[model samples]
Structures are given as structure tokens and as C-alpha cells.
Target: MINFVKIILIFSLMASPCNSLELYGKFAQGGLITGKVDKKIDLYVDNKKIKISDKGYFVFGIPRDQTNEIVIVTKKNKKEIKKLIKKIQIRKFKIQRIDGLPKRKVSPTAEDMKKIRSEGKLISKAKNINSNLNYFFDSFIRPAKGITTGVYGSQRILNGKPRRPHYGIDIAAPKGTSVLSSNSGRVILSERNLFFTGGTVIIDHGHGLISIYSHLEKTFVKKNQLVKKGEIIATVGSTGRSTGPHLDFRLYCNNVPVDPDLVISLN
Candidate 1:
């Protein structure tokens, strides 16, 4: 009778529905996580389906300001396996306030309204271009040599009114300084004389990663051009509501703006 009971227990253990599921990564904000499971699993962050890939391997990234506990669930054979990710530390960032920006710089006059509308249309068109960007995991290089004038996440106080936080890092450089591609990507937008950004160029770095270079003295790359890392794409300039010659570099993941400094090593 004891032997019979042991045999039954071993069979039940072997027939259990738990798969080889593992969720491993740094549990910090703005960090990337790698997940593996035996079967294709539906991934969710705060109850939003982000993505699912074949072979049960998927990647998810935490935003810089996210603080909620992440929950991952996989269901097989009507049984659910749940995993809770905790103790995530959201990094604290510095906030800067600028008090001297002129009113005209923040608000355009009636004469410039038409240009603003035109620029908006161009930005809308560029945002619609879809690029299967997931191959941009290479190291990033500085696009130009200059002093770091502005930083990411700084709150803007335009004429005593709080504005949206600045999402890009600004480098102060001389006019006509050559701007290079930070990583390999396909140019998605190249437009000159925008209302606010001036000569702007946007590159899609596969898998929803994009880089925007603004206030260019001249644009060298065209739309749909594939550029390599460190290749010259534009020249820095002071155009379109800028105080002086500088480059405003912005990075985005899908539609969410992210800090460029978080992914790249400036040193």
C-alpha cells in the first residue's frame, strides 16, 4: 500500500502544469527586464498588453517615473501562475527652472501662427511613419561636441507659468557644428524651418525607439535614408525660438518620451 501511494504522488508531480517560467532583471525604474516561459504568455504592465513574442521570450521596460508593483501572470490548463515584482526604486531626477525666457520665445505672434500650423502637420506626418525598430541595442555616441547646456526632466517656467517638463538634453555648441547619428537608424523625418524646432530630423531606431535632432543648421540626411552610428546627419544651429546655437536631442519609446542619458554613457 505504501508503494502504491508513492507511485501516485510521483505521477502527480510529473503531471503538474507549472511551466519553466522565469522573470529576471534589475527591478529599478527605467530598467529593462527579460522574461522566459515554456509557452507563449500574454504580458501585461498595469493591466495593459504590451507585447508577446514567439519562443516565450519577451522584453519589457519600466518607465523612469513608474512606481507601481509589476505583476506577471501566465495561464495554462486553467491554472494561473502569478509573479509579483517589488522593491523597485524609482530614480530621483533634478529639476531646473529658467526664469529669463522672453514671452515671445514661448508664445508666437499672429504672423508666426501659420508657420506653427505647418510645423504641426509635419510632426503629425512624421509620427505616423511606422518602423519595426527593435535592432537599436548598440552603444550610443555623442552627436556633437559641446557643453551640456540643458538636461532632461527639467521643469520649464515660461514667463511665470509652469510648462511641461523638458524631455531632451540640450548641448550648447557653435553654429554649423556637425551632428552625427547616435546609433544606426532609418531617417523618418527631415524638415527645415519648423516653427519651434527649426531644421529638425527624426530617426527611427527600430522597435519604437526614435531620436529627434532639432535646431540644425543644415540637414544632410533625407527621409528613408539609413544612417550608421557616428555618421554626420546635420549641423547644429540657432533657429526657431532658440537662444543660441545648440542641439536639442530627444528620445522616445513608442510615444513615451524617455531620458536619453539613461541609456547612453556620456563618458
Candidate 2:
């Protein structure tokens, strides 16, 4: 095993981990950072004001292609302190040519484009809700286990034509394989049918942290419902623009996509 994350801190507050401003977790491409500081201390990562839980915990995420270095600042008791975390860990994405996709999926006409735009708005609105609940501290679990087919940040070529880079991890499973919730959170959106993702479910696990599950045969939960970690929420299937039975899972922080592989352990 290799350590993909490299951490650099400007100063250490104390010998204890919980006393001063401390950042825990990996600092890499698609990495997540959870911080612990003194209560009532305001913290900002890259100038964005992030929420600090009641227990003095806050989390932030690094995007898959964040070229700029991360900057963290702390403001408390009329004093402002900042530190340069580190540069991003750039990844080499290979071109993945996926054939046998429907022509309409590859090249949608005006009518299909209309539907795509509408669904995109709905999805965006669902992910925009910044809830105050913090449930991500419990860790995440695999939604559906099988063979991994696609990875994050990979340039996808559908039918030999280049398309958007893949933003989620694709897992191949049986049509009826049960899909579990990656963490405990409230179901914000459970659209049964979408233009590209078929049945899509978006869970908000507090603050701006969210996970998306797409291409489902059926959704078991509804919007605004509370779900526990590892709860069965849907089943895998080849819906909407898919070539085979699989699930596309994605994780996001502050609405920006992050790599799910770095956030959780596969084994």
C-alpha cells in the first residue's frame, strides 16, 4: 500500500491533537480534510466559510483537478492566522473508450437536450441544500460491491467521440443487487427517472457533503427522509443511457466533485 496524501502544516499549536487548530485526513487530489479546533474559532479554507460542528469539528474537500494550492485560515478572538496546506496531487487520466452506447445518448438532439437541461437543474438544486446536520464522522461504506469498471477523472470517449471526464466510480453488479447508503444522512432528492442517470438519489450527509447514486432499478427512500449508514436505499440497474447493469457513485464537498476512492477504503 502507498500513502497518497502528503500533509504540510505551517505550525503546530501544541503536543495534543485536539487543543489547537489541527487538520486530519489526507491532502491529495480528491482528498477530504477534517479539522478540530477550539470552540467558537472561525475557520475558512480557500476563502470559503465552512461550518464548524457543535463538537468543534469541520470538514473540507479538495477537488479532483484543483490546480491551485490549498490555503487555510483561522480567525478567533480578533486574531487571524493562516497556513498554506499544500499543492494538489495531479493525476494522469487515461482515455476510456466506451462503445455500444445508444446514439441518442452520445449525441442528443434538441428535444433530448431540453430534457437534459431540465434534469440538470433539478440535480443542481438538490445538491445545493447546505444542511447543518453532521453525519459524516461515522465513515462511509460501499453502496454496492462488485467489479469496478470506471474511475474518477478519466476522460471518457463514447463511441470514439470524446465526452466529459468521468466523475464517478462505476461498479458492475446484478440488476437487482441491493445498493446501500454510503453514510447516515437525509435524502434530499430521489428522482425515479432522470435523463442521464435513470433513477438518481442524492444524500446530504451534513454541511456541503453529498453522495450521489445513479442508474438504479428502484429507489427505496423518499426526499427529506432520514437514512442510516449502510441502509438499503436502492438497487443497481442499467437505466438511462447505460450500456450494462451498474451503479455510478459520486461524492462531493461544497458541490465540487471529489474522488470516492481516497475518501473510503475499498477493502
Candidate 3:
């Protein structure tokens, strides 16, 4: 009887829930995860350091092209705890091809490249600003009404040459069409012209989430302005290297670009 009791006690001790972590998310593509963790524990995903919030919570996002198993390790006081490895889900996306001519057009020259590089520096600065607010989850609306010409994660063969996969969804609308805010966010950038993007706008939705609107005819909102969902922020145009009047909408979570279609439903 004494030996049986000791064996039961040992089994119970081994089954304790402490030193364990639970992770889950709606979508696993692009190496993204949202979960909770111990405050004092050091966390590693596939041996990479991840950022953790002060409340002992953490969210790590991976890019679309990365495909590998994730390993999470937590440590404290030289003691280590590891969770069972989780395999990342591979996403299969569709391809789209667009052939069109533009009414108004401009080509990038050597001088234009210099100007674009300078403007890129400003856009990069705005996207890195961190705010302690949760304004992104408030309702999302379409920025403009038009036909979706291009989709996210689509491989592009532009003018008979292959290019990088399209990261933004293209909305083909008439020139001067009003572009509204998809959700409440602070305007991080409003540039009039870029070499590839033409006029561009970026909004920070807090918690490392950001939205970018590119190829605009006109910009109505200024930098650092707080905008509400459905607010008119810009006008559609065929600026930059585009072939027609349209809006290119892109979304990112913690520097990892995500499919906007996953976050919001389109009408």
C-alpha cells in the first residue's frame, strides 16, 4: 500500500500544469501567433527573441515566405522549460495578371530614384512609432469602392518579366474617387509622390499593426492626424508606376505583411 501511494504521488507531480504554455491564433500563415506567457520567463521562437508586453503577454508574427516549425522556450534563473514544437501551416495563394494602359503616366529616372530614397526614409520613420492604444479593433470599412484588380500574395509577371509577389490588394476605381479610412488610426505619413508608389499614406493602428495606402491622386489628411473609419482620407489616382486609377491597400502586423482579406470582409 505504501509503494502504491508513492507511485501515485510521483505521477501527480509530473502532471502539474505549471511551466507550461498555451498558444493559439485564428490564422497561422506568415509566422504570426498571439498568446500568453509567463512574465519572468525568457521566450524564444525557433531560437529567435520575441517581444513581450509588460503584462507577460506576447505576439510574434512571421512573414509569408517563411516555412518552418516553431520552437518556443521559456527560461528563468537558468532553469529552462520548453513547449512541444508546433509546425507552421503552409498557405497556397492565387496568382493574378493585369494588363492595362494609363491616361496619365510618369517614368522613374535616375533623379527620381534619389527622391524616392529620401522619401522612403521618412515613411520608415513613421511606421516605427509605438503607441499604447488599442484602436485597430474598432470596426473596419472599405477605403474605396471599385473592382479588385489585384490580390495579396499573387505572383506577378509584369511586362513579361517576373517580379516580387504583390503584397497589396489593388482596387480599380475612377480617378478622383474618394478613399476613406478603413478603421480608426493615427496618420503616420502622407507623402505627395513616390517613385514606385506615387502618393502614399500610412496609418498606425497601434499594437504593432499598420495599414498603407499607396498611389493616390490627392491626400486629404496630414501627418499625425487621428482619422475615423469611413473618413475621406485621399482620392484614387494612377500615380507612381501604376497603369490606371486605383488604390493599393496593404496591411502589416509587427513588420510581417499579412493578407488584408483575412482581417476584414469585403462587400
Candidate 4:
């Protein structure tokens, strides 16, 4: 009966349910992963339904502190077709201490709290826009020329007080240095000054993928404007709660913050 068992194994392998599933990109925390499946199937990550493009392309993000294995499920109609388990690579973050930030900026006043809340709503609304543009499939470019001063997933201790982790890359450059668009996208939010991230601009790269430029000296693009890859969208500067002239660039997929440096390195 050994031959009979071998024949059954071959038939099972041939009929595997997830043969059409394909994935790409880093499978670690703060990483962006692109996936593909049969156009007729639905993809879900951790039970959240992911948006699949017309061409079967989809994307997801791993949060910085996601340490557990992610469960990816595919379904056709109401039937569960297959499941894939993705183990996340844990990251060790550095503790970054900023000594000289203004006390008010670090710990805002009651009036400042209102401004922070209002500005935060705008930023959140912009980043959560889901579009079908599909420009995220293109390779990304560096948004500025500068020395890398900070990195993603680093703990921030601002003015002697511990704060949240830094979710963006800080590129040190001279004030007024042009900041380019990392990918072709539509500008969703362009604010001249916010409470924290002054002169911020957010671009939607389609499929829940977005790019954010903060601490800008100037903004060249407006809300709803279409920008091309490497196009000048802003200039570097020390604004808001910044310590020096630098560009704080960030990327996100499905509203989950990701590493901008990792996204560019994917090219």
C-alpha cells in the first residue's frame, strides 16, 4: 500500500488550495508586503479583509511591535479555500533622547491641546484615504538628499520625558533643500503649519499606501494635486517640534505606519 499512499500525496500536492497565492517584500515588523492571488478570491490578513486590485495585487503592513505570527486566509465565495501563516521578524529599536525641545511643544498647554486635536483629525483623514490608483506598484525614490540622522521604530525621549516610538526616517539637510516625491501619487493633505508636524504634506500612492513629508520649509504641491516620482513637493526645514533642519519622511500601508527607508530600499 506504499504506492497507494504515494499516489494520494501526489494528488493532494497537485490540488493544493493556495497555489495561486504569491507574496513579496520584507516580512518583518514595520515592513510592507505586497501580495497576489487569484482574481476571484478574497484575501484577509488577521481576519481583516484586504483590498485586491483589478489585477489581483494587494498590500499590507506589519506594525513595529507585531511579534506574533500573522494569519492570512483566502476565500472563494463563502468557502474557506486556504490559509497561510506569516511569522513577523521582531526588531530591536534604539532609544533616542532629545534634550532641548521646548517645554510647551513637548507638553502642550490647554489651548495647544485643541489645536493638536483639530490638526490630528485632518492628518488622520488624509492618511486613511483608500484609492485605486495602483501607483504603489512602482519603485520608490529618495525624497531628499541628506544625511540619515534618525530611523524608524526608534524610541523617543523628548526633553527628558519618554515618548512614543519614532515611525519615520529623519534626513538632515539644509533648510530650503528640495524634497522630491518618492512615488507618483495624489496629494491628499497640504497644511502650512500644524501643531506638531509643521508644513506637512501627505500623498496617497494608492491601495492604502501613503507617503508623508513633515517639517517642511515650503510646500510646492496642494491638496488634490497629482505629483510624479522625483518631483519636488516640498523643501526641508526645522518646523513644529523639530530640533534642526531635517525631513521627517514616513510611509504607511492600510493605515499602519511603516518604515520609509525600507520602502525605498525595496527598489
Best by lDDT: 4
- For residue 26, model 4's alpha carbon misses the true position, in angstroms, by 0.8
Off by over 4 Å in 4: 1-19
Candidate 4, residue 265: Cα displacement in angstroms equals 1.3
| Clash number for each model | 4, 0, 2, 0
Clashes of 4: 0
Q: Rank the candidates by lDDT, best first.
A: 4, 2, 3, 1
Model 3 lDDT tens row, 145-260: 99988877888766555568888789999999999888889998898887778899999877677789999999999988999878999999988878889999987766677666
State the C-alpha lDDT per candidate.
Answer: 0.69, 0.82, 0.70, 0.85
TM for every model, in the order presented, reads 0.75, 0.91, 0.75, 0.92
Model 3 weakest lDDT span, ten residues long = 1-10
Model 4, residue 246: C-alpha shift (Å): 0.2
lDDT of 1 by residue, 112-193 (tens): 8877887788776665444555445455677889998887767777667777878789999999899999889899899887
C-alpha displacement of 123 in model 3, angstroms? 2.9
RMSD of 4: 7.3
Error of 2 at 53 (Å): 1.7
| C-alpha RMSD for every candidate | 10.2, 2.5, 9.4, 7.3
Runs of candidate 1 exceeding 4 Å displacement: 1-39, 52-65, 72-88, 99-102, 124-130
lDDT of 2 by residue, 1-267 (tens): 227443534245546444477666676677787767776777778888778888877778887778788887777664775454666767677678899999999999999999999999988887676778878655777789899999888899999999998888999999999999999999999988887999999999987889999999999999999999999999998998799999999988878787787777522
**123-200 in candidate 4: lDDT tens per residue?**
888778889988887778889999999999999999989999999999999999999999999999998898899999
